[model samples]
Target: MSKRATIHRMVTPDHLCPWGVKAKDLLRRSGYRVDDRHLKTKEANEAYKRENGVDETPQIFIEGRHVGGYDALREHLGKGPDPKEGKTYQPIVAVFAVTGAMAVTTMLSTSTSATIADGWAWIRVGELCVAFSMCVLGILKLQNLQSYANGFVQYDLVARHWVPYAYVYAFVEAGGGVLMIADIATLVVAPVVLVISAIGAVSIVRAAYIERRDLNCACVGGGSDVPLGFVSLSENLIMIAMAVWMLGKGSV
Candidate 1:
């Protein structure tokens, strides 16, 4: 006979506990027949928690032996909780990969007709990559401007002082990216991005390096969980470099 597992989870009209669902799925996949018990109301949930002497919901019992919550259940089943489930660089990696591919394609397509030196052509590709990446990131931020503002204020110096800067910042990035893509308005767009990115780089240095405070970066967007550190700093630095490169080329 298969072992029986019981899960006491909260399922209100407004919310269905996600961990509860995950636990049930895990138990079933592990060959255990689960008795899914829903605490439908807040009072019922509180009462069940009192009875079980537990502060949280989604309590699990395996074969009438108390096994605790989701994390405990995973440990009991000999599978540790996935380390990469929460904090991940997958989103940033995807953005970079797509932009890089676009840059390479654009470069290859124009390589034969290129009037510039080979080295300058490669630099142009790098500019395209940065511009595209910035556009994508800016779009993500603008999708949830309020959310991004909330996250941005945590570490951004300009955002902390002037709340509206976060929203403007998104537009600036997108605008600069668009101009860069068309290879137009380098005199204006390059300097604008350079100043913003320089300010951002300094802010990052102060927050992540000097202060040593751990926080989520709003680089990718408000919902992203990418850590506020080297990756974010590098992003700002790349923008700075691209802006400088464009300005230098324009001068020649």
Candidate 2:
């Protein structure tokens, strides 16, 4: 008898989250028995994150070993590929984060589909998800920047541009996230869609430069290893375009 391997995946309330489902399905197909532990709330999930320092959900562990998230698991199985790091490149921790985030954005931009009865539930829930994600990410980013402030602040970069830029981003994101709760507020969503997409574009560029030799992705607020290449670039670019098109049409 073949010894069945047991795989444990941490599943927070993000079951409806595309990435979570993808992780679950992929693990099942790999022939490992999946044990899912669902958390009660984001606070509970954060408690887990504190121990693991991994902010995202659907973490797959194989036989008690920390295999990784969806992308890492896929790579381990040789089914999906995230290439090895180049000589000068740091290890990448996000082989699938870019694509995953793109999928998330797609769901978030679907305001038209959200107008239907059941669809409203999905949209409203998705809005909450976005709001939660944004707030968590923004707070973490601000904290990270705080340490780096002295380096740039000495030159007045923060005073002249960084502070204003951050505020503009915060206002748009926080306000648009609130407005995104309903379809009638599509007007607010438009600018927000553009802003996030633009921010993604800049990040893609910066990512390329910062990781010229390839490196682990710190995009999702943790250390995840994934290959860096066209896949990453394409994902970000596609997401930017999607945001642009979605905002322009006032629907998806």
Candidate 3:
């Protein structure tokens, strides 16, 4: 028999894709080089069937024998070699591991960027929020702080103004910053930060409460925040656990 025959393996980047890898390794053992350059797209798979007569991964041929699918390949190679143990949902396990890892990484990266190292860093980060806060605080700043009354709360609080409240927050933030760097009160701030992140993530589910349409985004490369959407919920579950894990370790 001529050894010129080839095996064509079609594989998507799915959990069983690793099974494709295993198939290739076995192919090499069986004296055939498997080609898989065009394996992921629907067009490619359809094209393969049009060109050849098969439409599946690990499509095998032994010296032009047309041995067929994975089971055929198994028989040609001989039995009693090894038995694959019953592994439940191997593909799902792989997918979950990958997706969970990615979401947690994203959340950690975002939280780290929003945080400032000390009072100095806090002042700098707060300055960036000034524009947004000021827009909320606008012309009202010109009037006396007492001039504005909250009809709902019925309490006269500090009138919202960009420059005025921005400065106010900046000054108070200095203390939180110092506390973080000094590690004097990390426990208190850590819980509050987690709570804030949770609220921020959940509030997006309600359209009326949406102040800004997108995330601050400078901290995360994806330029999106983890809201309460399905993807966002998954991200937050991982992140919330990470926060708890760090808290348990007491590392802040």
Candidate 4:
């Protein structure tokens, strides 16, 4: 018999609670038979919270013992807290994974005879992935632009001296990505992208390698705990490579 657990989480038309989803997934992964309860309305959800004397939803119960919220459930299951001090690659990995899929799908949609055998197709995929990754990353940063600017200035040599640069960097990156994707103004966009990416690469090298300082990367987002190192450096280098390729190819 499996360990039985019950979870009451919010699920309304407009809002599906992410923590609730995470809690349920975690329970399933931990070998628990979960009785997932949905509080389908705002009023009902509030009432349940009030009756249970809990401040939030996604409350868990195991063997009739209250396990509290998601964090509490993690503790109850003997899983320690997520490492805040330690670096993580999960966010960056997820970003690239989505970008890669999008790149391939884009190729397929644009070309009737799209195949991996075509070297140009592969090059286009590479370019698309790099551009899309930049756009995605920029969007992430722009979600909390002020926070991103603060975090970015810590290591970016240009941002350190010119604080305003950090704030506008996301726009620049995303705009470049858009231009590259549209194959518009390649002569203008490619050189600009190359310069920014090269500067970013240099900044990462100076901060991570030369200084030997441990810092969180603002490449994905300001709130992310991703480390400042190879992954971040590679993001810039890949963008640089794409920009150089575009410049050489003279647009499409």
| Model 1 poorest ten-residue lDDT run | 109-118
**lDDT agreement of model 4 with the native:** 0.90
User: Which pairs clash (backbone N, Cα, C closer than 3 Å) in model 4?
Assistant: none
**Could you estimate the TM-score for every candidate?**
0.77, 0.34, 0.28, 0.71
Q: Which lDDT values do the candidates have, in the order given?
A: 0.91, 0.50, 0.42, 0.90
lDDT of 4 by residue, 8-31 (tens): 999999899988998999999999
Question: Model 1 misses residue 203 by how many Å?
Answer: 2.5
Q: How would you encode candidate 1's per-residue C-alpha lDDT over 94-135 as one tens digit per residue?
A: 999999999989888878755445787887788899999999
Q: Is candidate 1 or candidate 2 better by TM-score?
A: 1
User: What order do you get sorting by lDDT, best first?
Assistant: 1, 4, 2, 3
Backbone clash tally for model 4?
Answer: 0
Most lDDT-accurate candidate: 1
Error of 3 at 147 (Å): 57
lDDT of 2: 0.50
**Residue pairs in collision within model 3:** 134-162, 137-160, 137-161
